[model samples]
Target: MPDSFGRYPNMNISEYLDFFARAYGLRGASRREAVERVPDFTELGDLVNKPIDTLSKGMSQRLCPGRTLIHDPDVLILDEPAAGLDPRARVELRELIRLLASKLQKPGPDQLTHSHRAG
Candidate 1:
């Protein structure tokens, strides 16, 4: 699936993101929203209008993960999410993963209250 990133090498960032967004059943505001966010999420904001074929290895590395994450899967299974990224991209990926983990682990207010009472 990682190699699928270049399937449409001529597609610009927005089109590439939109293609996946639709593939994952996103529509209307949600589809548009995901397309907009993916560039920033992948640190490709400045290259959003550029064709995918032109992206550097590090840029492509970040973009692939952003595609995988557009659906917001409950359990992500990445073999090597930052394999070809530079040190900076690796750090950013680590931070993104940590943020995702914290968000997934945080209990809702109702659950927090029940846990406190049970304890």
Candidate 2:
């Protein structure tokens, strides 16, 4: 996997989001909607046209989680995702991450839950 900084490039923030969404399994308009909710993500999309090093540290951190979600990995491992975020941004980001976890599932009855109940 590419480092977080290596992910965002000279593309629209939407385009990169679309790219990563496809990399996972989410399709069509749903993934697009999820990405748009990110705070200041629109401006960040514009900023994506510039080199990443030019971004503020908070912006860079916010972008990294989006990049990880792009792939829709079966398991997501985040380290200090809210470290530098302000209270509001951290809360928003936390909600977004929760949504991502829910979406990443294969949409069944949650076999893990069923198995434990059965046992």
Candidate 3:
């Protein structure tokens, strides 16, 4: 699912990220929120709108992991998600991944808490 990034191959930064999320079943709203959280993401957002070939090596490197996460796969296999990101971006991305894992690990509050506590 390449979305605008892979599909149109000439989309703007915003369109790329937005479409990438949609292709992977993520809501456009959530994708925008997540991008906002990343440092200097506005620049990246702008880059996404441009031609993919216009991106520098580092920028292109950073975008790969972001697209991977937009889908929220059950088993994410990141070869090098942190490769070109700044330290802050890497840390932020790590926290996001941790949060996502936490979400997936926990059961519904009622079913999980009640069953565990009752026992």
Best by lDDT: 1
| Superposed Cα deviation of residue 97, candidate 3 (Å) | 9.1
Clash pairs (backbone) in predicted model 2: 20-70
Q: Supply the TM-score for candidate 1.
A: 0.71
User: Which runs in model 2 stand beyond 4 Å of their true positions?
Assistant: 1-43, 99-119
* Candidate 1 lDDT over residue span 13-88, tens digit each: 8899899999999899978877887777566888888998888776777677678777666555555556656667
Determine the backbone clash count of candidate 1: 0
Instruction: Report lDDT (Cα) of residue 46, candidate 1.
Output: 88
Cand. 2 TM to true fold: 0.47
Which ten contiguous residues of candidate 3 have the minimum total lDDT? 110-119
| Model 2: lDDT to the true structure | 0.54
Q: Write the per-residue lDDT of candidate 2 for residues 1-118, one digit (tens) a residue.
A: 2223554546655566666677677676777665564424323655644555566666666666666755445555555566656777666666655665465435312211111111
Worst 10 residues of 1 by lDDT: 110-119
